[model samples]
Target: MVNSDSPTTPLDSPLARKNPLTMENFHKFEKASNGTTDSMTAPSATISSTSFNSASLECASKETSTIQNETLKKRRNSAGHKKDYNQTLFENIDYLGCSKLNDPSNEPEMLDLMRVLDEQRMTSAVTVSLAVPHSARGFVVLRDTTGIELTSFPVQRIRFCVRGRLDSAQKHCFSISFTHHGINGEQTHQCHVFRSAQPEMAGRALYCFSQAFSNSGKENMSDNEKRIDYKFEAYLEIRENEGSQSSPHWVLCPQQNNTLKLRRDRQKRLIVQLKQVQLCKVFGPPLTVTKCFGMLLAAGRNLRHSDMQLLELESMGPGANPSVYVINAIWDPRIHVFDVLNTETPRDSRVFLTVAADVIIAEAGEPIRFRLEAKARVFHRDERFYKLPRVALREGYSLTLEV
Candidate 1:
């Protein structure tokens, strides 16, 4: 038996140094002892050992790097996470019909119509009664000054009586005229009244009569003309010759120039009235209508429970300065002086205006003087003017202008 452990020669010293060595000197000895004269010529064995050392070092470095990155990622995620209880509550709760929450102040208010009217005149009265039905069939009667019977000439004496269902959803209309008719051997003119949506009152009904006419030429009648013309004169009694009926008749007359009036009689009701107006200038130019109108610059603040009115605007470009138009505005009490430019950013930019602020206008046209200072700052003031079309919106109240 050979004693492999015993150091018999100097060549065995190299083998002993290579075995069970520390990591620092292992690479040094492995490189030094490789491809030597006294050592074995095992090139494949040397290559395998070198490759294993390099691979082990690479794996260890990568593992250390992964561990450090995981630790950093956890720290970052934890630091960024914050529990917002308000946001969480909003998310958890369902708000299907939550429009009232956004604008609680705009709720409709009850209104009393009779309280606004003055009923002072009771003597020498004109009593007009209108029987209106839910199914759109109705009639209006105008009593005479003595309140005895329907007038002989109802159309000439009585004005129009417009009656409809008290409810806001119904539609009704009425009209009347006079036409000539022959009864028995006498020729006379009769009145006709037309009612809409009522089959019973859809046709023309008798209303009044016309007067008589006399022939001017009778001496120039020849024998042929005498056979055809018998010089007959017929007089139409304007007041008499009428048939009485129990059914109610609607009295209509020519409307006076400015005597008609409208009365609103319900709570939370909407009334639309039309009036004729003569105007020289009409719609103002919209921002989209003309691009060369130029730019509008505005600065103002928005406060809670208040309207931000734009006072002044600086218009730029040639000719007359364009008007400043308000596009859209809202008040946020939490944010102050928020940059109007970057309001849609992901992170909240605390840009808002303080209470009671005025904007400076630096161009021509009418100098804007605002009443409310708390209104939200208008972006496109000219656009606002364009949106609310009609000259009435631009100028307050009503007046007759002749042009």
Candidate 2:
């Protein structure tokens, strides 16, 4: 009521008191201050965002550094484990100890010990005394455990000396027998006497001595001869065969004896001499023979030496090959007579005779005939006879007998 009665005061009125320009200035000032405050706060907010992004980057960098340190530590540990394995592998290898024992730097000491051992082991003493009027050659007697005895003929003059030891002391009581084969094929007489020990005892002693000799360098004669003046050895291999009723046999001096001595029951011995006997021969203009059924015969009617103008002879046993028979005879137009000479026979004379062809006869229509000229020569001719049978001659030919 007071405002309505008082004048229309502009300050009191709501519409009159508000100046448009002042209000507009106030609104503009308020907007400008608000804009300035917002600008200042926006910068602070951007600083906070930048600070948060920098903190995140620092955390990432710290994590990466820790991972790198762990990776580097792991790489260093793997290299140390491999070096310790190789040091323990090669510990025991000795090459120097083996070479020193094999060398013969002390051969004399070894020989002395061997001699002492040999004398102590002798079971008996054997002596042989022989008296000769002239210089005699040396001989060897081979004996074995089975009572096998072999006597070798006197060889050419050989320089040798006797060595013996008894009870650890060198003894000179042993003797050797001697014989001489005169140079002149004349009859020679000499009485050489030697004292011999008991047969069984001497055999045992000799066996022991032979063993010592074999052990002391005689095992390799070729190498031992260079250092020592004498080397003698003997070896006995006693093989028990199921079929043998007696003691083991001995094969002594294979080259010299070329025989096998088999012990049989009742002190009997079987001497199997490796003697070769001639088997056969074929001859015409040339000689040719077939080795069939351990027998010698012409291969065929047309397989004559005259047909091929060549001679071939073969062994009937294992590894049979054709061989040429050499003859000492002149070939004549009338008759090619071959003189069966000693030179024509093999030097060994051990071949078994199966067949022989002295001459070959051939006609156009008649069967060929091979004639025997001589008896087959063989080793131990006194023990065996190889006579050509009359039936062995061809149909029309006859054999000329030679006494």
Candidate 3:
């Protein structure tokens, strides 16, 4: 056998151009192979058992080496494989993009909701209740206000392309689009847009809350990781109805203007209330709501105790069943913001919810509209609501209905 590590002169090498394949070299190689074959096929019976054992061990070692070499080759080939840059990307976060209209002929009767959510009022917090009474279904947008009458139109379809613009002031932008029953027929699709100075504010809060809510599952994580582009999201309820009956308190739809003018005192209180909403979202503990026995149970996102003012799952009301007479609105003004507990993610997080107050209940299989009085966030406050959609459990919410 030749020593692989030993250096050989070009003249003596078999691969040398000077020594190309020749009859002599071929004969020598053929003889060597024949000898090896004969040796393998016929064993020497006269040899001692010790020699036989040694031969068997040598053969075993060669087989193992071949297997090791084959495995190494496989690993090396795998390492050289190219990555697929064109692979589809899956989104783990909620829809944080703005919706673009394909056609505007069909429009949603949206409220000049932004009139109430001005720059000064953004500071005030509104308490939101879900599954309430006598309400309409529509989404609100928190964009830079036009400083005039609100713009409302029926929507056809919503596409996922978050194209945003900042005015000369360079503020973030946002909007609201939802799926609802068309004013005309089954083929008709409509959405509503609201007027505001800070459109993206609501979405930002919702996204922030989603991150925190999902992270809550992994207890004891560092807070530093949570700080991304999000500001905050906490609570809010919204919906559309009866041509959205009793929507005047919060939204200013086109037809309602002649009959319903916003009261000065109500707007003033809302400003203050919206400001308090900011406080609760930042300093207050997270409200973790669970679904058990056809009811949403509220608790801290974590297992730890939390501040009062907000009710626990054992105590959170607007409960599985509420008084129909008083609790009959998507955004009922009768309930105080504080008593309602949550607000639209006024710079608050929504975790697993959307800005379209009406869309939320419908997709949740509840089919109800939620209205906000002051807590920038708005949600319905009733348990047994209209349309009665199949309660869709999403985000991290459990589908299991515990008895």
Residues 1-403, model 2: lDDT tens digits: 0032344321233321332212122223223222111110000001112211111000000011111111212323434211111011111111000000111112222223223323432332222222111111112332223333212222111111122323323232221211122233221111111112322332232232222222322111332233312111111111112223445332221111331122112111111101112333322122232222111222123334443222232222222222321221111111122122111345444321112233221222223233222123222212221331211111122222111
Candidates' C-alpha lDDT: 0.19, 0.21, 0.22
Relative to the true structure, candidate 2 reaches a TM of 0.13
| Model 2: lDDT to the true structure | 0.21
Measured with C-alpha atoms, the lDDT of residue 211 in candidate 1 is: 7
Candidate order by decreasing lDDT: 3, 2, 1
For every candidate, C-alpha RMSD to the true structure in Å = 50.6, 51.7, 33.2
lDDT of 1 by residue, 273-315 (tens): 1111223234222211111211122224444423332222223
Per-residue lDDT for 397 in model 2?
A: 28
TM-score of each: 0.16, 0.13, 0.15
lDDT, candidate 3, 1-403, per-residue tens: 1112334322233322333322233223323222121110110111112212211100000011111111222323443322211111111111211111222121111111112122223333222211101101111112112222111111111211011223312123222332222223122111122222343553343232222222212222233333322112223222222223445333221112111111111211110000112233333322222222111212123221122122112222233322110111222234453332333233233322111112122123443222222212333332122333321111211121111
Error of 3 at 208 (Å): 5.5
**Model 3 lowest lDDT segment of ten:** 55-64
| Candidate 3 colliding pairs, count | 83
Candidate 3 Cα deviation (angstroms), residue 350 = 54
